[model samples]
Target: MRVLYTSIFYLLLPFILLRLLWRSIAAPAYAKRWAERFGFFSALTTHKKVVWLHTVSVGEFLAALPLIRRLQADESVQLVITTTTPTGSERVRATLGDSVVHVYAPYDLPDALARFFKRVKPSLYLVMETELWPNTLAACAKRNIPAVLVNGRLSEKSARGYTRFGALTKPMLQHLSCAAIQNSVDAARFVALGLSGDKVIVTGNIKFDLSLSDDLRAQAATLKSQLSNDGKHLVLIAASTHQGEDEIILDAFAQVRASSFAWARGAVLVLVPRHPERFERVGQLCASRGYSVVRRSEHSWNGASDILLCNTMGELMLMFGASDIAFVGGSLVPNGGHNFIEPAAWGLPLISGEHLFNFAEVARLLTDAGALIKVNSAQTLAEAFVRLLENDSLRVEVGNAALRVALENRGALDKTLLVIADYLRKS
Candidate 1:
């Protein structure tokens, strides 16, 4: 089955390259990293054995940052991070600077994996979330490199899909030195999929351990003061919005403004589209809605724009800090929403759509505590916004609930680090 899988992947190589070229039309960074994808890059410092940590994109990259910092502190290891998206690559560069090496994760073909392992020669491999590439794991196993899946999660839907290919997936799971999963449910799923029970442990979600730095809070404070003139206006941020969610958010914001809600007066809406490629489209969308808009990258808000388009990257947490009310996107559409951990940590009143499989447990924790409400449509979202804005008691109640949940759910980082320490000790 693994052989067949590799053969099929080889057959799809052309289509994959074509898809890269297609995406490059919007994000040119995709075009420039062709060599890296094929596992062609200059060698890193060969003096120290590299500890390679792979994160798929921005969310995974952010979730891994705390762990990466922890790993970097160990001067015995040379830390290198790999990301699949340009945005993640950019974030790694901006956040870590030259402290760690950043590179594009190679395509998971055998030859690519071989070349990558030969060049990078990682002593230990850690993959954030549930990115299980058979070729990559096989290569790691072949090299006798310790490979652990850190902060791992497996939703039921994903589990079912993986089970369909148990022959291929089981060996990959067995190849993993450890699976430091987020919850017992994920641990059970991994074990059921052929990972030994001893190999899989519930270490909880590392995202819960996310902390807002004083510097970030200060930046948010300054931006909030500048934008709202020190609480003169309410700030509504629809963050990580998808293609369809922006239209709904704009409609809902318009409805809120037209409604009799007193807080709607001079309210500013910030639309932060999830992908950088859609930044221009979102900016145009807001403008087309008759919103006077200012891009965050331009850094010149006239204090008059109805909508502040956050075109900048690596500033979502800061923007969330400034929000009076936050609507996390991806849920509004079928895409299983982005992480709501930041908003909860910031103690903001949160609203999301009904679809939250990606963050099912986190959403449940917030919803059960009255910190988050799920809206089904634009009208409902508008109503939720107006009600939350008008009722300070309700907003405070929900926001406080969110903060309590965030505060209570921390310590995952320590537990996760313990798992890594065990792996290192055994290896």
Candidate 2:
């Protein structure tokens, strides 16, 4: 079954590169680093224990930052961080800045994995989230490397997909030394999909362990002052908006402005699309709806535009800090929701659509705390915004509750570090 899977992957290689070429038309960064993907990067010369950490994209990289920082304190281990996306690569560079070995992850083909293992020579692999590959895990097991799946989450949809390929899935999971899952429900789902029950433990979500710096707080304060126009305008930021969700958000914002309240009349809408390729399209979408727009790239923000389009990266938390209310996107569509943890950390009242299987545990916590509101349509979204906007006291109450939930959920990072300590020593 594994051989068949590898053969199928080999046959699909050209189509994969073709799709990569197509995506590069929008995001040029995707075009570079082809050699690294083929496991052709220069070999690392390190006497220290090599620990490879894999984070597929920006979200996972950001979520794993605190853990990465903690691991860095161990001088005995040489960290080689791998990110599948260019944005994640850029983030690793921008934030870490030569502190670790950053590289593009190798393709999951057997030959590529073999070449990668020969070059990188990792003794322990910390695979973040759902980046399990049969070839990669097999190579790790063959090399006697302890591969630990950190901050693991197995959604029901993904579990079903894995179950369909149980022949390959069970062996791949059996290779893992351990999996520190987010919640018991997700842990049970992983066990059901053939991960050994004893090897999986519920350490809670590490995303709850977000570290908000004083510098970030200061930046948020300055942004809030600049965006609120000296406390006159009600600032509402819709963060991480997906392709389909933007239209609903724009229509909902229009409806929100229709309210008789003075704050609603002068409310400012900040649109931050999920992907950089869609930044121009989102700005254009706002203008097509007759809303004046200002891109963050323009660097001329005077609070005049109806929609403040965040065309920049790595400033999402700052955006959340500057906002009075936050409506997290991705849930509005079928794409399982994004990280609503940042907004909740910033103590901003949260709103999202119904789909939240990816973040079911975090969603439950915030919803129970009265910090999150789930809206199904534009009308309901607008009503949610109005309800929060009209009652200042209610907003403060919910925002405080959100912050409390964030604070209460701390220590996952510590538990995860403990879980992986034995694995790291296996080197």
Candidate 3:
């Protein structure tokens, strides 16, 4: 079955490459790292004991940062991190530095996977979130490398697809030695899919451990001061926003601007599109809405624009610190939402759509603690924004609650490190 899957993948390789070429026209990183599909082969020759960690994109990379750091600090292991997206690669490079090897994961074709396995020769493989590739898992199993899924989550939406192909999905999941899931719900779902209940442990969401270093916080503060001149009444930042969400946020921003609230009178909106390819589109979207916009990539903000489009990578957390409130994107449009914990870690009051199945546990915790507001539509989002902005006392109350929740969830990294260390020792 794996061989047949690999053959099918190879047969479609040319078209895949062509599509990637088309995407690279807008996102140059795609073209720039075209050969990175075979990166594992090249990396394997240098390190004696390689531990491979796969993260799909920026969010997963951020969630795995502390674990990556811990792995690098271990003298017995050499960490090799793989990410599927350019943003994820950029984040790993920025955060992990020279301590770990960074590469793009190969396609799951047998030849590619075999070459990758032969080169990297990983003793252990750690996959972040729910990125399960049958061929990749099979390759690791064949090599006798213990593969584990860390920070695993199984949503109802994803479970449906898995159940649709239960035969294939069950065996693929069972290949993992263990799955350190994000919550009890995820654990239950994984167990239902034929994984041993004993092999699935609820570790909470690792994203709750996200925090900016003092230097990063200081830099963001400086940038905020430069942009606002310390004069803006409040700043509402919408980070990692998707397509429809951006329009909704813009409408909400306009409403807030027209509102009677005191803080709304001088409030600024910072819009950051989720993908780099859409940065210009987002900037244009803001401009078409008749707002003076400043692009962070091109200009040092001077606080004059109605909105600041943060068209840069690896700075969302810093941006979170500079803002008074945040609306996490990918939620309103049912993309399952991005990490809300980034803002919460900074004690910034947050707003998000009702659909946060991706980080359901974290969302529930924030809602329970009165740390976040859940809005289902544009009007409610505007109301939440205005209410938080106008009432400084309420903002501070929610902010404190958010900070408390973030602090309370800090030990996942430590616990994960213990598990990884044990694995290394046995290996």
Q: lDDT for each of the candidates?
A: 0.89, 0.92, 0.84
**Candidate 2, poorest ten consecutive residues by summed lDDT:** 418-427
lDDT score, candidate 1, position 1: 79
Quick one: best lDDT, which candidate?
2
Over the stretch 193-241, how does candidate 3's per-residue lDDT look in tens digits? 8888878777777777766788988887886776566855688899888
Candidate 3 residues lying further than 4 Å off, grouped into runs, are: 1-4, 39-43
The better-scoring model by TM-score among 1 and 3 is: 1
The TM-score values for the models, in the order shown, are 0.98, 0.98, 0.95
Candidate 1 vs 3: which has more lDDT = 1
**What is the C-alpha lDDT profile of model 2 across 145-223, one tens digit per residue?**
9989999998989899999999999999999989999989999998988899999988988999988899999988888
The alpha-carbon root-mean-square deviation between model 2 and the true structure, to one decimal in Å, is: 0.9
User: How large an RMSD does model 1 have?
Assistant: 1.1
Candidate closest to the true structure, highest TM-score: 2
